[model samples]
Target chain A: MGIEHDTLVAISKSWGLFYLIALAIAATAYALWPSNAKRFEHAKNSILDDDDKPLK
Target chain B: MPQRADAAALSYRDCVSAKIKCLRYYRQQKKRVSRDRVSLLFMGDNDMISQLTSTERQYALVILVLMSLCGLVMAAGGRGDPLGVHGFVVLAFSVGLAFVLISGFYAPQPDPEQQTQYYDDPTKVGIALTMAWAVFGMFFGVWVASLLAWPDLTFDQAWSSFGRMRPVHTTGVIFGFGGNALIATSFHVLQRTSRARLSDQLSPWFVLFGFNLFCVLAVSGYFMGITQSKEYAEPEWYADIWLVIVWIVYFAIYLRTLARRKEPHIYVANWYYMAFILVVAVLHIVNNLAVPISFGSAKSYSLFSGVQDAMTQWWYGHNAVAFFLTAGFLGMMYYYLPKHAGRPIYSYRLSIISFWGITFFYMWAGSHHLHYTALPQWVQTLGMSFSAMLLVPSWASAGNALATLNGAWHKVRDDATLRFMMVAAVFYGIATFEGSFMAMRPVNALSHYTDWTVGHVHAGTLGWNSMIVFGAFYALVPWLWKRESMYSPKLVEVHFWLALAGAVVYVFAMWNSGIIQGLMWRTYTENGVLAYSFLDSVEAMHPYYIARAFGGLLFLTGTIICSYNIWMTVRAGKALATDNDAEGDIPVFARNAVQAGE
Candidate 1:
């Protein structure tokens, strides 16, 4: 039973890594999608504005 | 001729003004109609129709198919218990999911005003429910401890009665209470920090419903003796899966909000919250790697055994204490302490250093729990060393929090919430110091298998977790309900003293009893034979147990009083309506002052 459990654990570890990679890909794609492009532009403009603002 | 020219100019100005008015009215009407149409399509009737999107439908179908396959495997192995509660929970979850997806698809094109209030009221309800549950849990805990002390109690009877109730009390406080508080507050925090109302209405409800559902399943399953028997990881496979799903959504919501944040730097509190969420997810998934025997059954086998299993379990367990209990509360401390005290953090540098130190060291300290067991001696040594080293970061945080109150002592006197948080920091310092001491080999020899461990845990859980939770509740209720002050300041004072005195008595009594028991167990008759019977140690504990129960009762009483105080505040406390354009929710106290002046 111990040996069988160990093997199953190893399988799960590998599967988890794969799932993590998939999640990352999905997340990145979602962020960079066309619908979000305007948001990105707005964020970029805001960042530039911050660079110009004086320290509080 | 001059009069005619003046009249012509006035007529032209009037015509321009009328044209602009007509255009503005037309636009307003269009917006109103679109918003109404969207609301009808999304929120009108069936919640299910609102939740299910094409993508979500596909995901649910896949899960359903996979579950059926797993069910078949379970049937083949003659294990079929999980199919009952598990099936119903999954179906309910699917219905909720469908509603959210459909809502996302048809929801109005973001009216800021309407969206702002949607999650606002529900989150307050969640907070109130959480406080109620916590008080109930304390009552249950005191009851269980009393029963455990009863002389007439048989092993079977004791186990049957309190064994089930113990897990319920634990889960009720931790997941039910702590989980709700964290979820509700995080929603509020994330929104303010991000400078955006929540993205969607249905998602917040989904997260809230999913969390409560997990709690229900965990507590009920434990009573049925359906558990994996892993301490702190007792919830079986089905419940674990539900948490994973809920957690993923929670993570997404937080991330999406952060992506849209108006703040330049993610606030220190947010960093701590994110770490807690991310690390706990990793820990839960890794430690709970199990294969179910069937869909509806409680029986499942963890995929790690012997030393490996021990290692993995403690890794999950200690960190469960560290992240779930410690880190999350630390996030609350960072936010609420400063906000209530009206002071800046003493040192951002200290906060950052301690945060990193805690995250790094706590993972290694779990092996201390397995000291002197079948685990490797080297692992034990590492665990002990790391546990000792952990004091630096722990104290760093405690010191930083205390130091933040350097000029704010007056607030501590009048503000019961600040008092709770200040005491929580002190308890954190004491608990961490004791924890480090207990990890040493010499001390572990005396403390292991004794009531000392129990005392240590309560110091952390009751002293640290409960106090921090109380502080958060005090901070949150007024703000959430838009009230000026708590219903009774005197009751808050009474609660603080009661809880503090209870913790002190409880810990000191248990510590003394545990050490005496340990010494008695190891004592030898001058001729090199064991001197004390096991019953002798048991006999020694009777008085202490009685004292401990008294302590628990006091704490329980304090908690009940607190719940009442909060309930009354919600019911009859004067509302404040301070304008908050950027974040729609008014500061409760500020609003009250304004109303009073008016």
Candidate 2:
């Protein structure tokens, strides 16, 4: 017999959960990557440069 | 003998040049004085001058003429078709615009050396409107609370009844006060973070004026018994259509500005603002789909009837809170809190995580508001699950804000504005947690349709949203006016205590009253008999309602103080230059100090 409907529903739920987890981890990894460290640091301090002087 | 004669000639020449140099300096001073006199003719109000670009100046001239025309038409229309309360409001606003334009003829200069590079004038006006609305909204809220305490206070008119005044308070605070604050801060944050000016000047004014026009229509229509009966989406068909147009322009302005960013990466705050703008448009359009009874009439029927309509309205309702209040204010917090504390955000990564989580989850959680309704079980479950998941991001944002203040906690103690931001974050955490808990079906069974939900909303609006907004206002007003500090720090301190005490009293009174009401409703005796009648519960709530009114009064008093403080601060800035004047450097409050080589 084919898989029960409840079983299929359960699998979908778990899959959705797994997908979101993977996405979260990927986002975290991207943020923490060594290559991104400098770029992100620059972004954090970016507002400090917003002085009243004209932009070039 | 010849060498001695040449030396004497050289000495005579040096003496003559020294006298000539002194004469030239005196002549230059006279020329400078003449130039100053000429400049004074053009710059009557040096401090309050138009910062509009050339293109924007043209737009202002066109808008001024058009507004006057519209004002004349509305004035002639009286209470006739196409010009009811809407006409009067338009006329009033047009008069205001005319006054501004007339002033510009006399004082049409920008203090380039003192002002921000970006077009910040719109944001300044928006903040002023925000405070005006805040006081008015809080006054209505106090009135509504008093009416609940003593229903007889509503006079005799249907327009003055609790049913009517309730929406006035809600719409006034939500759209009038909170909406203006969002637009103002979003513009401020977007420009600073992007390191660019707004895309254009005219569109900002269009959005501001048009949006407020929608608010006026909504509120006046309510007083006139016009409604679609949807909470938070109560404005009838025409008002909704006007809002759609205004919102589209808002979104376009935001997107255009983002595209013009000098920075390579978009800031986290912009992402939140973008979401707020886009999602609100979607929600407003989808939930307000309706057919007007007639072109002239204000009545309309919602396109989706019965269960579908309920689901759609709540979807719009809950997300209005999610997007309009929470997301937008969170955007405000991310920028202002860190900037005010003079610290970088604790973790940019967490901001990313929370942004993604909240944006994705909040849309799904709207159904939680319809938990026990005719909505299907599975849909409710999905809503509850998403709401529970939302806790992660909500706490992340709150935690992120608190952490940003790690080494800058002294700022919170010393600066009332920073303290307001800190307390707002704390309240945000509390409200979000309570939101998830109440979403569960079991708890909703007890708390739904009770004052508990009301308490929870105030906890968010008063404790979270208003606190952050007050902080931004305090920071923004002085900076906008080119002042070193507020007129009185002691007043800020007093306002803070009043706000804190008011919120605490307001929230706890609601908690006690809401729980009691909820418990009474759910109570049953032996043989399946009800322990208390519905009227009994209402009677019990009388004292609590009065307490809530007192609490609202305190909050109202605090806001009035805050407004007074801001007004005096602007006056002080006009009277004397502070800070940067001594060194001829830009004021620290005007913009953040840039580090070396950055």
Candidate 3:
């Protein structure tokens, strides 16, 4: 239940460093991932299924 | 012979291709059913089957890639405590990979014949499970309270041992009973409304498996004393990671199914569910920002410091109540109320308004939990203000549900499920009102660190959440299992009154004890010395504690009877062939069929 101030500070630094690295990796992966047109079309079709039909 | 073999092989390939096309058609039919008002209920089974198609494969793929990337980053970061993070990454990968692989191998075969089969009624299973767990949890609670009161009692006293089983009661009801029932019923409703089958078999299994697994780990870990010492976020780092993975998959599955929905507009219930999912994810991540000393170690340190840590922890803690306990149950309210009453929502506009109001206001109210503490005074003020404002939305939603039952008071007498839901709304009103009053700074001075807070929580969890869950289970099980009626409607009535009375007695006694202790603690001798030893407060609570245990026992007994009734209903009662009955009946998917024909 009790934590020393110095120990707390050290933990925060480690967390900061970890988060930064995580952000960088996520950014790079997003850039490198392949774009699939078929998949996009499927997703769009799934959402707009009944929109194209006239209302009853 | 060689020529015949070659022809058979070619035909097999053709069959596979044909099956893919059939699945696509089923998916389209599923969408049409959702758009149709009269056919939605029938569409749920079909939509679940269509989820194995390649059309929705991208969502699964994206989740896998993201989970893998997160793992890689955590592994490479090498923060000298990568074991827990690494284990999570690996587990996530396996779950994701397994889903993708299964979807590929089982590529949905479209039924050219267009036959529909419905089995394994998830609603019935969920309802039965929820009732059983509710009873178990209540009894366990009574046992714990009895031990806490009788200090001389040893661990060998099965019904009076409090030290090891408190978490069991809490987790059993909340996570095991209530949580599972919500997921099961929601899954059924989502599919029906969306006009889509579950996207993939593996995903549903993953959800059910992962959730039960977390429950197992949590209860066992509690007894083992392997906690992070945080309330609600009790399971250590490993358990937290597993939950995170399960949650992401849950979110992705929900979104994917929504994408395939036949309805042009998302229902009010889905919005509440999304809010619950999104908010809980944010709260879980922020509150659980800690570093495990090692993978096998039971120790970890929260990344926040001093006042900031306290602020962040309570923020996460309180909102877990807000989103997980409150909002998720609100989602249940939206769907189950309308469905049971055979009425449209009282006002969609009101639902939207209340949703936004709750999300915006609940976040700030977390700081109210830290009133009169080291937290900044301004922060406390903001918390109190938001806590007061929260009443508007909370009551708005409660009002909406109650209004939907207008002109339908007769149903409350005949149907125990509707009765449970209606009373839950009342409790929601009461608990939120009490919460706002307690958040005031002056009131908190007396209420803080008293039994009053405990009463407030039970009012919400037991009275509000438990009642709605029971109602939902009562409505869902018979419908899901196609049962004509419960084995014993009398038992449901008994369960309801017993549980309600028990909750009232429990909350009222604690309220009295809490206020008395608060007043005693603040009382001063003539010379300004403390008037009461802390022991005096403890002694004052003895009677209330004993009363609470007795109340809990009554609630527990009621729950057991309810569970037994449901189990018998599933096992022995004649099944209803369709949703149509003497009760107001509206099929969920007929609107889409009309549209498709047009």
Candidate 4:
């Protein structure tokens, strides 16, 4: 039995911002997790590998 | 071994002769390498060192012949005619094309190789055109700014009138300069990040040439007083249709390349570029719905009317900034800033969040430009809310860029290129914040129809867009020309100061003028009558306009210097190869064969 404020304004205020913020946070967390470090590092350095050559 | 009395003299003689021989060999080798480098500069890297196929040679010949014919016809038909601007332009362009074709066909080509690499000629052409248009656009920009300061500069010519030339400046900068830069850089970045060459060479060339053709038509149409009266979407129906065709090819080419990407995860920068290409196509087509007067005429009437037209136009206009100006440039920022700084993006996760947030939210936020109009109230609310939420993603991206410089602060301080990029990020942060607030109804009441809006646009364009473009150019020129560094680091520093000073002065002048104008328009006497006449507000704006002109002059000076710097850098590369240990040696990037190696 949580508190209930079911009006449009209240619902948007509570859920809309909260949901987006949460999603952003979760995405960030997933990205920063220890296991994903290698993937990001590889992606970052890929550009440097061919830096001597033109992108073509 | 004989130990003769003259042994010392003999030994010295041999040593001097040996040294002389070594020096002579060194000079010859240098000459050979220099000649090879010159050839490589004209034709791109070793991969492109091949003769054209017979079909290609034939195509060039045919095009050159056709262009010559076109030039002759146009010049003959329009002889001594007063209203022959279009004819003159066409004739000149055709002649130029003919000359280019002749040179391209006649130029020496190396033997054909077993395999060909990616085509970079289009990118090179795009870069050259970008620099050319940047100079032309900024010149027009300064001219218009001067016109505002002194209306007498109009000289009573319809062609040179402020009204006509204003779009020339805007379109020149946005489409001509900015657009070309985006196309060139996107081609370069896409290939590098995706680890794939552009899927087809011909399509990319078609896109670049076709897009520029549209630009010429649009600018020329404006001079002839031809318009559908839409802001930033001013091209007539034929031009719009042509752009639609070109854009489709662009989208197809981009997708084809991405499909060939070697990477498992599509990079964040590509995501931004994709959004720009896709969304711009949608926005351009939807907003440009109109019926033409005739096939030959440059006239059209919008399919929508009244408040609906206003809504549609602003929707297209605001998002033009979103996708065309912001997203594409942001894509450049994401790739270039990190590359220049020699660091990984501080948070790959944040970039993903920011990308999605910007793409989803920016579409809805366009409606905010129609606020306080007859558009439905709910729509306005939706627009405002979306704009507010946009701050998060916008900041996220900017934050990511700044954060990447955490350990690279020394580079930012020492390297003008990185400094330009970092400053651009800061400007992006400032402009986006201003945008969100201005969308609010309370703030819009004062800011709308005032100079404040103008200041905001320049803050983004001059500050965010131009600075980042300069940074990219600095990074690109040495690499493209195979040089060690810029012609002069001192000049880069000077250009940076001039650009910073100009943008700051321009933005502040507009801000001051805008606030005063807005306040005066809203002011009323105690009897409830307006305190200041509209003309009075305009009269008060004289000093600020002059100040803006001064600011524009500074920026123009900086741009000219940049153009000269790049030109000299290329020339210096040639000079360095031949000169014996010249003062301005090649930059490390050129000598080391890569920028910042392990």
The number of the candidate with the highest DockQ is: 2
Better of 2 and 3 by DockQ: 2
Residue runs of model 3 more than 4 Å from their true location after superposition? A1-56, B1-129, B154-164, B577-598
lDDT of 2 by residue, B1-598 (tens): 8777777776666456545644653564455446544232222233223655445666676876776676565446544543445656666776676666555544555454433466676787787788888998899999999998888888888888887788989999999999999998898889888877888777888888788888887888777777778998888876788789889989998989888787888878888998999999999999999997665556689899888799899889999999999889988988888777778899998898898888878987988888777887777898899999999999999999999998887888988999999999999999999999999999998888899999999999999999999998888776665555788889999999999899988999999999999999988999798999999999999999998999999999999999888766654333222223322224345343432112
Global lDDT of each model? 0.73, 0.80, 0.70, 0.78
In model 2, the runs with Cα more than 4 Å from the true position are A1-26, B1-50, B53-55, B61-83, B95-99, B102-116, B574-598
Q: Give a tens-digit lDDT track for model 3, residues B321-372.
A: 8888888899888877777766666655567668777876798799899998
> First chain TM-score in every candidate?
0.53, 0.64, 0.43, 0.61
Per-model TM-score, in order, reads: 0.76, 0.85, 0.73, 0.83
Worst 10 residues of 1 chain B by lDDT: B40-49
Residue-level lDDT tens digits of model 2 in A1-56? 37765775687589867977887788778877889777777887776553643354
Candidate 1 Cα errors over 4 Å, as ranges:
A1-56, B1-112, B115-119, B151-159, B577-584, B589-598
- lDDT of each residue in B317-374, candidate 1, tens digit only: 9999889888888988887777666666776656766777787779879999988999
Q: lDDT by residue for model 4 over B1-598, one digit each (tens)?
A: 4565357666566467546645764575465456655343344333331345445555645754664464455446545532234445545665665555555555465444211343456676687778888989889999998898899898999988988999999999999999999998898888778767677555676688768877887888788886778999988776788799889999898899889887877777888888999999999999999986654345679989987798888888988999999899999998888877767788887887788788777887877888788887766887898999999999998899999999889989999998999999999999999999999988988998998998999999999999999998898777665455788888999999999999999999999999999999999999999999999999999999999999988999999999888867765443323122321223343343421211
Query: Per-prediction RMSD in angstroms?
Result: 11.3, 8.6, 13.8, 7.6
- Position B67, candidate 3: lDDT: 54
Docking class of 3: incorrect
**Alpha carbon lDDT at B76, candidate 2:** 62
Model 2, C-alpha of B390: deviation from truth (Å)? 0.4
What tens digits encode model 3's per-residue C-alpha lDDT throughout A1-56? Answer: 59875675566458744764575455444323455334323332332232212111
